[model samples]
Target: MDMVSPHTKNTTELRDRKRTGEILMGHGYKRGAAKLIGVLVALVGFGLVHGRPVDATDKVRIALSVRNVVFLPFYYAKDRKIYHKHGLDVEIIQMRSDLQLAGVVSGEIDYTPAIGPATLGAANSMPVKAVAVLYNAPLFSLVTPASVSSLEDLEGKRVAVSRIGSDSHRFGSLMLENGGADSKKVTFIQTGSTTVSLASLQQGAVAAAVLSPPFTGIMAEKGFKVLGRSRSLVESPWLGLVTSKQKLERQPEEVKNMLLSMRDVITAIQRDKADVISYIEKNFKVSKANATESYDEIAGVIVDAMFMRDDQIKKYLEGTHARGETSKLLAPEDLFDFSLVRGLK
Candidate 1:
């Protein structure tokens, strides 16, 4: 992909903002917040009449669990204009894991690169389907203060997670269970996000926390010790792309384009480690060492293709059941639609 000069990119963004403002002003919206509202309105497919031809590129809104390295493929796709190259105007939205499914089901968000456990639960209740596995292994670590050397030491102490029933919660519980500590003996605190969970740990409000890359590296750099990693406890599909079945049926070409863009992103990141590292450092606001550490920790897990094995999905479901989150056994077909990217290389 050809790179756009920083000046050119900034100019383009300013022009787009100006256009949005003009459209909103014509629609009787004041200038101050019109640009923001105009962007939102355009994202939801509302036509704005500016006496100019409508944009031919399809707009897609995708949700992320948080702004972390685990979703780097989507980030790289947007940053490098891979999505645009594939004829998509992708808007990335970050939100809590629990709310992402609702956005997809309500048609407010077009795709979600959500956690496997939560995605399975959403699939069981709705027409949403997992179309791609971005990371086949859990990207979280059971981190504890330096004084608390082992998982056993966390007994009767508070542990923090992004939220209950989130990937962090499941990973923390599994880490405790694998260490022979009854998770019931530990108090799980919901910290809203990994950044906050780390803050809770720093404040000594929680003895330990389950954190993913970048934040995990940040905590470790602050003198915390990693008691365990989630990948060691479970081998399931960790993160994947999800969309409604209606989307697959109604916009097959667009879905294919999105997947193709994702493929390009994976390829780009894999082939250009320095660029990805720079992106990580700039976006996460971490040092070069921290950024490289985060990328190294997660690079091995990102897959080039979108498909997840049947056994992998089954193992994820089984793990979720073992954690007592859900009792129903869902087959691979019940949770995912592998057919979407079947022919994509």
Candidate 2:
């Protein structure tokens, strides 16, 4: 009638404890099969009773690059069980800065798709590897009031970017370069968030604001015109899912399955736009018209081959080289991985 008590550590770390327990028990330790069974029960009990972590691995712990059109693939993959189908636990983390090297270095997350910040991290040598492409475009746009017709109008006008060093800032800079405007012409204000930026645009705080997906779509529906969109460029020069090189070398099939899940989600985005739009609207507050625009924008960029356009990568690389960023970067070869989605044709 003797009962065993559970261990102190959480279920996610239980695997390690279980392994250690096995080692101890192998040498005739008292914390016997009963202890192992107790730990198993504890994991099941916490998950079943409290609805905590998902898989035996606890959670896939993926950092999603903000909630936007670019993330449609992940939204579908998580909703459609594609990540799960690939034997993953799959908890989608919503974050803007995907460059988070400290966490990735310390093993806090399993993976993340490329966002602009992560691309910067690669250019700076952050030990990240681009795994696959979610959408093959910039997935961002600069929104302006109806009064502003072109980038020239933006000159001497207040424009909003997320921050001075952020991707939105870079995007605004690119917009200026495209339009042949002087750098000092636009104010490049630092109001944050798509909603806040939209508000700033509406309130005359900023004549224009750079934002993404449903955000741009929402403001555009409300009479804000898209002054410039990153997708409008001839090529997409971005990265996603910048995984650690260690993961790429040790579990390449797992990486392949992850990319496969992402591609399958893209297929769904093209085929079943409406089914996913509800989430888009609920999360992004995007209007149906704007949702349509965002969805179309996403689908148009997903070529027959599921990978990013190679020419685009080459151009981006060349630009980085011109800036002398790649050589200065550590483990430059780990910056990208093209084996999975590249063969999807």
How does each model score on lDDT? Answer: 0.69, 0.59
TM accuracy, model 1? 0.81
Task: List ranges where model 2 is wrong by over 4 Å.
Answer: 1-55, 309-311, 321-334, 342-345
Error of 2 at 285 (Å): 3.8
Clashes of each: 0, 7
Expressed as tens digits, the lDDT of each residue in 135-240 for candidate 1 is 7788778888899867888889999887776677877888888887889899999876665776788999899988877777888888999888887766667677
User: Candidate 1, after superposition: displacement of residue 143 in Å?
Assistant: 1.5
lDDT per residue as tens, model 2, 1-345: 000112111112222446534644443442322122234334334532111212355565565435555556766677678788878767665433522442343234557655445555555544557776555666668787787767887778788876666667765677777877665777877654555676777888877888876677767778778878777764653535666655666666666777777767767777787877765655555677777787777777774455555556666666655544455433324365677667653
Task: Spell out the clash pairs found in candidate 2.
Answer: 60-90, 112-241, 113-240, 113-241, 114-239, 114-240, 114-241
